[model samples]
Target: MKKIISWAIIIYVLYCIGMAWYLFSFADSSIPAEWKGTTADPATFLTPREQVLSEQYSQWKNFLFFVSVPYDWLAYLAVLWLGVAKALQTWSEKATKSFVVQAAFYVFWLSIIMSVLTLPFDFISYRISRAYGVSTQSVFSWMRDETTDFLVNTVMLFLLVVVLYGLIRRFEKRWWLYAWMVSVPFTIFFMFIQPVVIDPLYNNFYPLKDKVLEAKILALAEKADIPSDHVFEVNMSEKTNALNAYVTGIGSHARIVLWDTTLQRLQEKEVLFIMAHEMGHYVMKHVYWGVASYIVLTFAGLFVAGRVMNWLIRRWGEYFHLHKISALASLPLFLLVISVLNFSVSPVVNMVSRYEEHAADEYAIKLTKDADAAISSFQKLTKEGLNQVNPPIIVKIFRYTHPSILERIVFLERIKRGD
Candidate 1:
């Protein structure tokens, strides 16, 4: 029975891979005639070496996409099935009489094991980035970032588990409802603090040094009615060569951040378009909508996951050492179920994200009246990131949160023609 199930899963993984390849292999080769002599044409701008490098990087990214989730599922299953989780449960319980302490201990050990499992792939990804000149971070700095990321994520998970299990013990059947209620405020709090507390941990940030450019960006914000604030910049050149800017945080905590790399790489006009695009996100209320969508999804997912977890515990409690839904051993089962649910909604999330990003592009163009700068900025961004002009359909569906550079550039050109 187990063999049959394993074979079925293997077959399904292959089917999905095949479908992704099918979608990618048929990439739209047709470029509109108007874009022929422009930077919008990949061939016009990309050197032969750049084209080869981008293609190679794209393939590596797609390979990782194919393997990442299945690898995670397998890693978690191994910990569960090989009795590591059960042993941790036993040890954590023996270590403390406090249920909360046990939960924390279990979470810590589970995170360590998961990190170990993920490290090889993570290192592979890092090494590949270095090879492609995408990341300039030193090995020590990269390792430091990884450790900090793991610790931060583990602490968050531990807190969430404490809340989840405490509610389960108290409410039992209605735990999901309470969890959702708790999560809404918790999510907002995290976002509010992230830009202030969490962001500074990874990189140094300060007020933008270019006073003249800062004035322009601030004026643009005023025009957009997003409230005036200081524009900030982060030291990004220490880690990567990628150029990016975004509006992060909520309420008074909100600020626009530019990667120092962006300032160095782009012209002043191009930088304005990028910053204007980030402001568009605020003007369009993408952040609020995103938070609302996450809240809605979690409510439904939690209810469904609770049902699935309860069913699994009822059926195979003793077999898997999961005698109760609240048992520390069952965290893996809960996570596995929740992960599957997340995958189910991944496309919808990406779809909304893409729409918001495309809207932001148009908004930036209209606000700045610099279709040329937007086009050039996007083209430079693609080159810096080594992103393909147009990814495969499957990649677009699963990975892209913004319209393809090809589409974005073409749209800008169309508007330029009308102008």
Candidate 2:
């Protein structure tokens, strides 16, 4: 017991050290002064009031960044520490003789407990977004969304848990390999269906309504040689005023979506640039590469988890209230390792994402040949999103999937200048 508690404390201490390290790393990280031009600097993108709001929003986002990872780690830890994991396992067994039912039962309760434990961090984020005039959701509506989210997550988790534990029972030594083998297809299927199945549960999606704009976007797609019928738009203005557009799904299911907020706020040219950027993802086969990356990360993560789970159980099985790594009670420990692993690898993932986004941006500019439109579109994005033009290095590494707004706009500004 003492050993387990000691290790937990040690892990948390190391997490604290990592948080500090990220801050220090950000301090040392710097971008080129030349990127900040005399006429069209990133800082010049925001007005005085917007600068204040952006700074405030950045501070809150950074605070969330520091706590969110730890919150996930501690949720798993709390379940294990408080005996909820063992209790839930026992209850699931007592409730059903069937293995599938037991898996579903256990996963459902475990997910709920973790959600309840971690709800505050998410609630804080919502409240922060609301306070900043970024979220239009009411408290009840927000809670409904949260509930819908966890229920969906629980169902997906139940499926994965059944496969994982079933593999463990059948081939204890090679369960990780088998589980990952299953996951590659499972992940692809999920990605393929998400735009059609899971996404619609949250918001309405339909063809972009404006015929003139849709025709222009389809022309842009044809110019890029992207096979598409029509542009899709989601009712984002119903939720928030933030502007966003992206490519989702894979292959035939693949389509570009623009937010109605974006369409309403930007000019026709700016909107086309946004759609062109999304088309670039399809043109470059980023979805396939992204899936490949996810599969590789899962393979490595599962392998490490298998090794670590066995070591911990071997050393302190009794302390953990479990006799073997395959026991359902050991799940929290397994997930704890995975949570830490994912957090540790996130910077590398985000780095790749930033690169992809940059490539897409370049593709969009080339296809549109409208650097002025691209620059102004980004500036508008920065304003509506309350995005800090020059965020610290820590944010650049962990939170940002796209290059910073300042970086994108400045790059396009250079293109406009022929520099």
Which one is best on lDDT? 1
What would the per-residue lDDT of candidate 2 be over residues 18-124, giving only the tens digit for each residue? 76555544343233687654434545666678777877786677767786788688777667766788898899889989989998888988887888888888989
Candidate 2, position 383, lDDT: 81
Tens-digit per-residue lDDT, 1-419, candidate 1: 36744874797688667755654464553356876778688778789799878877887867676677777777776677677889999999999999989989999999999999989989999999999999999999999999999999999999999999899889988999999999999999988888889999899999888888888888888899877654689999999988898878887888788999999999989999999999899888788888889999999999999999889778866556677887778888888888889887888899999899999998998899998899889988988989888777767877888888998988898898895
State the local distance difference test value for candidate 2: 0.83
Candidate 2 minimal-lDDT segment of 10 residues? 22-31
User: What TM-score would candidate 1 get against the native?
Assistant: 0.93
Model 2, residue 96: what's the lDDT?
A: 85
Whole-model lDDT values for every prediction:
0.86, 0.83
- Which of the numbered candidates is closest to the native, going by highest TM-score? 1
Q: Candidate 2 at residue 415, lDDT?
A: 84
Which ranges of candidate 2 are over 4 A from the true structure? 1-43
State the number of backbone clashes in model 2: 0
